[model samples]
Target: MQRDKLITAEVADLLRPWFSDVTVGAQPVIGDAPAVLEQPDHAVTLTWRVGSDDPHDIVIMGPRTQARYHLERPGRDCLQLRFRPGRAADFLGRPLRDLADRAVDAADLGSKSLTAVVQTIADGGALAASQSHAARLRSLAEAIPVAPPTHTDRAALHRRIVAEATALLSIGDGPTHEPVHRVARRLSVSERHLRTVFADRVGLTPSRFVRIDRVRAVLARIQQKLPEVSSRAGYYDQSHMTAEFRNVMGTTPDAFARRRWPTIEACTAGNG
Candidate 1:
C-alpha cells in the first residue's frame, strides 16, 4: 500500500529527539539513473526495503565523512530513519566512531528491539504501497525499547557538548564560516578536546565537518552565479571553491550546472 502520508505525528514526536527525519517512499529507477552525490553526513541512517516478497533488506549506515558516488538501478520501496547527530550511540549502545563510513546489516548490531521491529514489519507484510505509514510507525514505536540510561554525569555532559558543537559547525542559522578553534573556544573547550569528542560521537573531525558543511552550503546556492557562490560560500577564490567542490562532490560546478543531478532520494531507491 503506497502510503500517501508522512510518518505519524505521534511516533515522529516520540522519536524526534533521537531522529532528525523519517521518510517513506517508493521512487522508481530507470535504466540509467544519474549518479547521486551523497555528501558527508554526521548522523546515522537505517534503511528498510519493503514491498517485496521476503522483504527483510535492512541496512544501518553510519556517519560518513567522504563523498560517495552511487548508481541506482531497479525500483524500490523503502523507509529510512535518519538519526540526529551524536544521538545514535545513545539508542544503539555503541560509539559512533566504530560505525563510521560503514554500512552493515542491521541484525549484525545485535539490538533485540531493532530485530523485533524488523520481524514485525516483515511478518505483517507492511509494504510501502499497501501499509499506512501510521501503522508501520506504530509498530516501530511499539517495538523500540526505551534507551537505557547508561550515560554517567560526565558522559552526559560530553554528549551535550558534542551536540552543541555540531549545531555550530553545521549549515544552520549562525555564520557557517566559524573556525574550529573559535567554535571550541566559544563552547569552552580546547580545540583538541573538541576534535576528540567529535571523532568519538560525530565520526568526523571538526575541520572536516566544517568543510563538508561549506560544500553543502555552496550547493544550496542553486540560483546564484559561480562567482557569487564561491564568494558567499566563504571560499578564498573561485579556484579554491572549484577545488573543494570537486573534492567533496566529485564534479565541477560548471558540469553540475549544465546537468542538474537528481537528489539523494533517487539514489536511495537502489541498494548499491
Candidate 2:
C-alpha cells in the first residue's frame, strides 16, 4: 500500500500528537481505486481534499445523522485528522451523527475556525492544554443524545466482535460462500454469538462486513492494474465482481472507473 501523506498545516497539527512518528505523504489513484465506504467508528476526522474544477470532493458515509463520507476525487489530495468519537462532538459542539450519510460542503464549517484549530495543533501546542480543551468539549457534547452504542461494558464482548470481524475481513478473494457455522468453528465461537457481536457493534452482520471488505480489496486491485482484478479480489468471476460492486458502490465497476476514478485520484494527490 502507498503511504498516506499529510500536507496541510491544520491536518498536520491535529494528527502530530498521535501519529508523530509516522510520515504523511500524497497518494495518486491512477486506475480503478474507487473510494470505498468505511464502517463508522467513534472518532472525529477533519479532512480537506483538493479538487479539479471544484474545491473539494466530499461525501458523508454512515447510517448516523452526523457521520459522513468525504472524498477528494480526480486524484485531488486531502488532509484529515481522525478524532475520538466524543472528542469530535465536543470540539464541533454538535453530534457528529447529525451529519451522517450525507455530503456537506466543507465551506459550511467556516474557514476561520477551521484554520485556527488546524494551526494550533500543527504548532506543537502543549498536550496538557489540548487535553483540557478536549475535556471541555466532551462536557458540552454530553448534552446531546445520540442513539448509537455509547458504551461497551464487556471487554470480552468487544474483543470477540473485533476479532471476528477481522477474521471475516481477511477471507479469501470472494464473498464467503461457506455457512456461518464454518466461520464460527474457525474462530471457536458459536455462530449466534458472532452474529450478535457484529450486529451490536458494527450494525452489520459478519457476512456483510466481509462482502464490503472484499469489494474494497477488489477496487484496490483494479487501481493497481493487476491482470484479472476480479480473481485477484477473490471474486469467482467477473459477474460476481460486478454484483458485489453494485451492492456496495451503487454503480457498476466500469462506471466507477470512468466517472469516479478521476475524482479519487485528485483527492489522494491533493490531500497528500
Candidate 3:
C-alpha cells in the first residue's frame, strides 16, 4: 500500500481555534491486520473506500477507549481526515457522544454534502491516481465550511475546554492519577458539568477515559519491550496489571507482547 501523511499547513491557523493539526492521509490499499491498536480518542475519521463506486463514500469512525480491538481491514483504498476530539460535533452538527465507538456513514448522519465530498476524495485517491492523497485531502479541507472562531464564542470555548480535558486525562508516567475535581476546577467547570460535556463531545467520561488511556500507555510500553511494567502505569501490582489486561484487552501482557500493533495506528481487536 502507498502511504502518505500530509501537513495541513494551509488551514493550520484557520483550524487551530477548533482542531488540532488537520493532518491528512492517503493510501492505495489497506492491508489485513489481526489487531487494531486501542488508541486514545481519535478525531472523526472521514474515509473513502477506494474501488467502491458507492456515492456514500465518507465513513466516520468515531473515537475509541479500549486496550485493544479486533481488527477488520478495509477492502479498498481511501483518504482519511482525522478530526480531533471535541471538534467533530460542530462539523457533524450533532452530539458526538451519540456516535461513540462506532463507524457510521456520512449519509446516515445527514452528512450528505460530506458524503459527496468523500466520494470526491475517493475519486481523488483512486482516479486522481496522479495526485497525492494528501494533496487531494488538502484541497478537500479547503472546500469545507468550517469557519474559524471569530470571538470568544461560548460553544467554541466549550469545545476547547473539553479537548484540553481529554489531553489532561491522557496521563503518562505522572502521579498515576489526578482528581477529576482538580481538573474541573482548573477548567472553571463543575465536575458534573465536565463529565456531561466530555461524554457528549469527547465520547467517554473523564474517569473512564483516563483508565483506558493509562492502560494504553502500559500496553505501548510492553509492546516496545521497554523495562516499564504495568504497575509503573499506576496499577496496584503485577496481578492488578495482568487482570486489567485480561478484562480490558482479553489477554495477558505476555500474550499481548508477541503481537504487532503500530503506534498511533489501528486494527481490529483480535486475539494476540
Name the best candidate (by TM-score).
Answer: 1
For candidate 2, write residues 153-192 as lDDT tens digits. 6634554554554555554545454455677777777878
RMSD to true structure for each model, in Å: 4.8, 10.5, 6.0
Clashing pairs in 1: 1-129, 1-130, 2-129, 2-130
What TM-score does prediction 2 earn? 0.47
Lowest lDDT 10-mer window, candidate 1? 25-34
lDDT, candidate 1, equals: 0.68
Q: Write the per-residue lDDT of candidate 3 for residues 151-212, one digit (tens) a residue.
A: 35877777788767876766655635556888898888999999988777776778767667
lDDT tens string, model 1, 1-272? 12236666677666666667777642322224365445566678877775542423777777666666556445655677787777777666666667777877766777665676667767774555666766666666666655535469867877888878877777664334567888899989999999888877777788877787777777677347988887777778989988987887667777666655434443432232
User: What are the runs in model 3 whose C-alpha is more than 4 Å off?
Assistant: 1-5, 8-43, 51-53, 66-75, 112-116, 119-127, 146-152, 172-177, 224-227, 260-272
Position 184, candidate 3: lDDT: 93
TM-score of 1: 0.80
lDDT of each: 0.68, 0.43, 0.59
Please give each candidate's TM-score.
0.80, 0.47, 0.72
Query: 1 or 2: which has the higher TM-score?
Result: 1
Rank order (by TM-score, best first) = 1, 3, 2
The predicted structure with the larger lDDT, 1 or 3, is 1
